[model samples]
Target: MDLECSDLFEWHMQSGHGKVYADSFALFISIPLASLCVLILIS
Candidate 1:
């Protein structure tokens, strides 16, 4: 199981999907946090 997980991870990094997913994930998380920060500053 561990080996399979590592293999998949390597494939993702090599294929460039890893970077895309990471960027999207960062945006997904940051957007909500940013909005919350704005709301706090306004209030």
Candidate 2:
């Protein structure tokens, strides 16, 4: 199990840093919209 996990992790790390930027962009946009919806519901 440990070996499998390590292999998977290595494969993921090799995939490149582009995914990190894309994920961060999605998170940045989603967090504010999610918070706004929550605030509207509370009000």
- List per-candidate RMSD values in Å: 3.0, 5.3
lDDT of 2 by residue, 1-43 (tens): 9999888767766789757856888899999999999999999
**TM-score of each model, in listed order:** 0.67, 0.58
Q: Model 1: how large is the Cα RMSD against the reference?
A: 3.0
Quote model 1's TM-score: 0.67
Give candidate 2's error at residue 6 in angstroms.
35
Off by over 4 Å in 1: 1-11
Among all candidates shown, the one with the greatest lDDT: 1
Report the Cα lDDT for candidate 2.
Answer: 0.84
Cα lDDT of candidate 1 equals 0.90
User: Taking the tens digit of each residue's C-alpha lDDT, what string does model 1 give over 12-33?
Assistant: 8788689897688889999999
- Provide the overall lDDT of each model, using Cα atoms, as 2-decimal numbers: 0.90, 0.84
Q: Indicate which candidate wins on TM-score.
A: 1
